[model samples]
Target: MNLLFLTFTFPLIGWLLLSFSRGKWSENLSALIGVGSVGLSALTTAFLIYQFNVNPPEGGVYTQVLWQWMSVDGFAPSFTLYLDGLSLTMLGVVTGVGFLIHLFASWYMRGEDGYSRFFSYTNLFITSMLFLVLGDNLLFLYFGWEGVGLCSYLLIGFYYSNRNNGNAALKAFIVTRIGDVFMAIGLFLLFQHLGTLNIQELMVLAPQKLVAGDTWLWWATLMLLGGAVGKSAQLPLQTWLADAMAGPTPVSALIHAATMVTAGVYLIARTHGLFLLTPEILELVGIVGAVTLVLAGFAALVQTDIKRILAYSTMSQIGYMFLALGVGAWDAAIFHLMTHAFFKALLFLASGAVIVACHHEQNIFKMGGLWKKLPLAYASFIVGGAALAALPFVTAGFYSKDEILWEAFASGHTGLLYAGLVGAFMTSLYTFRLIFIAFHGEAKTEAHAGHGISHWLPLGVLIVLSTFIGALISPPLAGVLPESFGHAGGEAKHSLELSSGLIAIAGIALAAVLFLGKRRFVSAVANSGPGKLLSAWWFAAWGFDWLYDKIFVQPYLLITRLLGNDPINSSIGLIPRLVRLGNSLMSRTETGNLRWYSASVAGGAVLLLALLLILN
Candidate 1:
């Protein structure tokens, strides 16, 4: 309990050592440092959780103040750790799942260049995420937020030799920054009006100071939602996540599963109090989630690359979490976040194995009948996919996702409830579609699955967690978060769950019908005029990328090209240009020709004298 700081210290040290090693270290040494650091952090978190459960903290919260960060005229914020059920949950996910991802990366990235550098960035990402969750004040949280963003840029572009990878990293950084700036402004607004960035203080003061739907509260929450929208990869700002697949598979798992993408969901849940006061903004959160989930689900259905399919699935799952937040199912949101980490990470790591086994082929259509070759990966995908599709009773996703649907239904947000159901069907359909097409058809490529304790161990653990066992490990959010608003018991809840389960099963069956055999029917439809148009549209992620490219990227590039010479700087350069010209002319006049020099001096004197005479 007293050594809560150790959790952060371990990962921070790992990042530093790995970073300064300069890639000169042995791969084994790098693996040990990277995996060991997060392992220690995870161990520390587990111990802390044990202590917390044994003897709960006062007020269900504990604040560990390390130092006074700054003080000015009655404003003071400390580098403090806030321990509660929420942060504890997030801490467990970041360190626990993060450690697994790191362990698996050691196997996946073997013989790859910059192996040590990859771990360094991931280590820093974990450290920053820990601080983001545990920070007691908004300022401290924002510091960690920016740190995570920086580490993401580094890790996403880990293969900097590839221009596409660099561009993906840049896209992620820039898009998320747009949201971060909005969040920064929101923080400033809160501090300006409320006079403090302390989250606990703001929570208490905000209700006392502002009424429901207050203008100030509304704008501030909306701005914060902007940050959440971008970080979570929700609509309008979601184009970068698919492109982010340019990084290694382990990097994809870390970002999409336990760390970066989940940050926005955590942010909103952490700041739920602010949003509650702004009902419209709170509802808008649901609307955004609903829209993004449906859009992403459609997009995922058409994706061929194993990783991109998972990437879009990540976006869609995150939308579910956001919908939970928006509908005031705070506990449900965090619960789903935890379960999502388990299954999504499993899916990604398994995909990594499949990619490696299939000689780096990513298109699902390109690799087929791999279930026999890579039994572990096939089992991983089946289990993870079952959870992702929310298969009834046996899968973790069933429990968490059903809760969201019930909450939305009970909250009387019928529209969102319908959207969630539609997304669920799509999830089941595409998840199985990928599995059936890739694992069942005749082998299109030779594949020899890799073997090692590092690979099997992570997949094995995650496969278990993706089952009902994961759902049983509940988040300790009772006192930490507000009670969820939409709780319905008896037949209504059961019926909703039943319907959702049926919907999921129906989707899986439909997928088998379409893709299990020769894939002739699916192919025919895909090649048809309407189907082709729709497939192309959805394959392009509903043209958000294309639209953004045309509306934002291309126009911005055009402006940049137009200003390639830097017209403003060129205009500013004119003064120096004229001065240089005059100097050049004067220099020519002073060519050491004594007659020319004398004539110029005499002419200047005559002109001066004439001017003086005219003035007199």
Candidate 2:
């Protein structure tokens, strides 16, 4: 047996079991099934990774075809598994990080009202993401892509009783759907021109078949980028992720932190060949990434809610990955993705512990002096923050980001490099802002509870992985990618790395001074006119939500109210009204009156005879 399907199959089994077991089975058993399915999948995937390393596939690719999906008029795609370095990276991240998050959730959701439901949704989420990366063809990938979107809606709205959460979920679904439509159009165009939707074939033939500067290729790739933008929460499609904190913290860590938000990067990486066919769209990817990262970083700065800060942070980090992809630094992008998953998940999970300890209080300003009470979580957060800050050679983020910065510099994208540097500064400042406020001040609220192995273990593991995993994995990860990956710069590499490292350090130092040491400077800046305006703008996500409401939403609602019912729908109502009139007229003519009936028949006969006379 190929055994790849087992990754999704086991999780599907668990999700189904947990779905029905709610209120019918013991909580402990439910927890086991929920966690065990993903755990087993993780283990199996690890074995597969080991096997892949030991005997790498020929041409660094493997495909397992389950069956032919369609053959009408020779348009055939299949239920196939496209296993390669890229899919392998995603699989490891999804299964591995997902399993850990599930473990953490087992503790986090303990004694909650819908614990089983949470696990069921979480399991299904993992299954969907797996299918997304594992699929062999564009159509199959779209199935998984839509699957994750549905799962995001369900999980984000897991607390259906809360109206805000429900709204947030709906917002996510509707916004992402915009990108999905563009992607569908793109796929249709590609299939229409190329006559195939197979991933491998597209990768092999796209560059050759599609000439340079082809308008069709540019439009098609741009459309695909739309889908990536929506799913990954880049730029205009990014307004939903912060509100998505309406869901559980585990979901924040699992879906938003590690996997779902990175879907855009993965899509671009997987289809790099197609993107290469249109450098215009490729440059746009770089530009979008640069702008989004900076925007999200600004949004993260003034956030009061700890989870929302992480939410913004996730968006910003994915922006970095996008930047890397745009610069033709594919390996650098994936490296950052893996490292970001580890640290970001660690941050969110550790935040969960803080929330649980503080009686679910999420305001970092209200939290104070947790250094003693939540020592493990405190340390774990420090590790996550350090990695997030990319503290030189000590953390995984440093190496991953160093590669991107050098690549950006080498590719002559100095403006994007500058943007990356600025984004890094803001990332550090926001991260440490929460840290200093939450852990340094006197305790404003008491945290009396301390968690055991279930909480601390996952946090500890993620903390360790966040610091070391990227460096260890980068070498082999590079090999698995395309030939363009991991190219070394002559002498600029060292200088570039040093400059980026100092920029990161400077960001940390500035945060320490402003937030930790000198508070009055911050107050002075806040009172300034420009500062106030910028703060208000960034806090409102650059007012995209407000602009969208005015431009798109209000008009829609007004139109609906005016035309949604009765008179507006009278076009449809016309048929029934006309039918009633015809029935009434016929009935009136037939009202037990043979004279009226004979006159009507005579008129008809006269008309027929007149027509015959005219013809003769």
Candidate 3:
């Protein structure tokens, strides 16, 4: 417990130091402190994992309370930390991959003007992300949730010198706020019904205490899902994440891939018991996840910017995890989440290295045939691509992603299973397509030729990890979950050896044909009638973003315009107009001398008395 406190404390300390010493410290020292604090946290997490493994706590969950945070009537929300297999997995990923991204940023952000400021924001991000995963209660989770949101806004707009970056940050904040609103409502509903925000308590109480299939349960689950969708960048709320590429690469890697975005997945898994009460809502979750996956995959295909492609890819991958969660494969969802952090972070960092080497050029068309120049980057990118493509047997992505597909299939949601499979093929194609076009084709432009050793070292570490981590979860991470939840064995069936392996091979084959074999043929098709449809499919992300823009953004903009011009501005002006009119009327009344005023008053009284006598 002490160590857990220290893990969060160090990052806060780093934030404080960097904030106070802003402009006082050298860039190198500031970067070290910022990254070093996260590194320390990562070490602490390692220790926690070890301790938990050795003790093997009953129900595989550990809860520690710091103090009573809030209590009213019978409801209580505590300041606490919950450690379990699920949370430990998230902690390892956040701190481990996050630390690497920070280190990479130290080099990638070198010589930048806001270097110290960047590190400060990074430290703050780490602290908030830790709080998010570590928090034992919903209110505390909300705190961490908003903390990450704030940090994202600050860091996304880190280059506030650019108006565009500032706008991007604003967009991100506004979009996620929509989801946060729903989540807050859901939290309120939970506390009202269950009388506690402690996750462990809620999980225990939900199965027996709360009435299953109630309308309120459905509403609560849906509201929570809405928040998750927004935070995870799924479907309608996903536009902000693509635009969030306006941030620096390392920031994108951390927020989009490793930490902030995954909060939604954690939320769902943490409250799995709540979701289980509403089967319809669970199906809705699966559908949303599937649709998001396919839509975002298409978006990735059309994007020309290196980071935007990865941004959309992150959305797509997260959709897969959500789908797993929707089908009651909570453990599988988390397993994918863990593997995803390694490969996705690797891809982003490698791309950052490429961008830095190319003098900040991000257009892949401007890039080609640099495999020899940056072999390390090339290798790292391939490793990540392999994982993303889910090439059979070898990559960590295969283990997790295949498990998701298998679970979806066995869960008896045929439509969702089909969509997920299609998404797998699309994922395979676009991922390697990026790799082939950027690294394998002829050199399109002359840029900075190669990366420094620092670039390759981190990439190497991630590659090694991505290659091996899948085996840890491959046998099945959830043998105990069903027993703990009192569910029947084999409720969710998966075939690791046969069905998953075949689908993975099919995905790889499709990618190879489209990207590697007959490349010109593929390009020609993209130019032809059917190819145009495919390209268009990719461009509009099958119109998901456009649909959302029309439904939400356009109407909001129109309302804003009307309010700005007529209601808000006119009302403000009316106050002054009324004041001026009162002054004008008073000026008329204030005319003249005291004798004239007395005479007027006497005449009025005499007339009133005369009228009264006539009436009588």
How much does each candidate deviate from the true structure in C-alpha RMSD? 1.5, 3.7, 3.8
lDDT of 2 by residue, 57-126 (tens): 7777778888888888988878888788889889988998898899889899888888888889889889
**TM-scores for candidates 1 onward, in order:** 0.97, 0.92, 0.89
Superposition error at 571 for model 3 (Å): 7.3
Looking at model 3, residue 155 earns an lDDT score of 88
Give the per-residue lDDT digits (tens) of candidate 1, residues 1-616: 7889999999899989998999999999999999999999999999999999999988889889899999999889999999999999999999999999999999999999999999999989999999999999999999999998898888889899999999999999999999999999999899988999999898999999999888988999999999888888998799889998999999999999999999999999998999989989999999999999999999999999999999999999999999999899999999999999999999999999999999899999999899999999999999999999999999999999999999998888999999999999999999999999999989999999889999999999999999999999989998778888666468989999999999999999999999998878889999899999999999999998778789988999999898888978899999999999999997777688889889989999999999999999
lDDT (Cα) of model 2: 0.87
Instruction: List ranges where model 2 is wrong by over 4 Å.
Output: 475-480, 484-486, 565-568, 574-616
Single out the weakest 10-residue window by summed lDDT for candidate 2: 477-486
Question: Using TM-score as the measure, what is the rank order of every candidate, best first?
Answer: 1, 2, 3
By summed lDDT, the worst window of 10 consecutive residues in model 1 runs over 480-489
Cα distance off (Å), candidate 2, residue 614: 22
What is the C-alpha lDDT profile of model 3 across 120-145, one tens digit per residue? 89888888988888898888999999
What lDDT would each prediction earn against the true structure? 0.94, 0.87, 0.82
Candidate with better lDDT, 1 vs 3: 1
Candidates 1 and 2 compared: the better one by TM-score is: 1
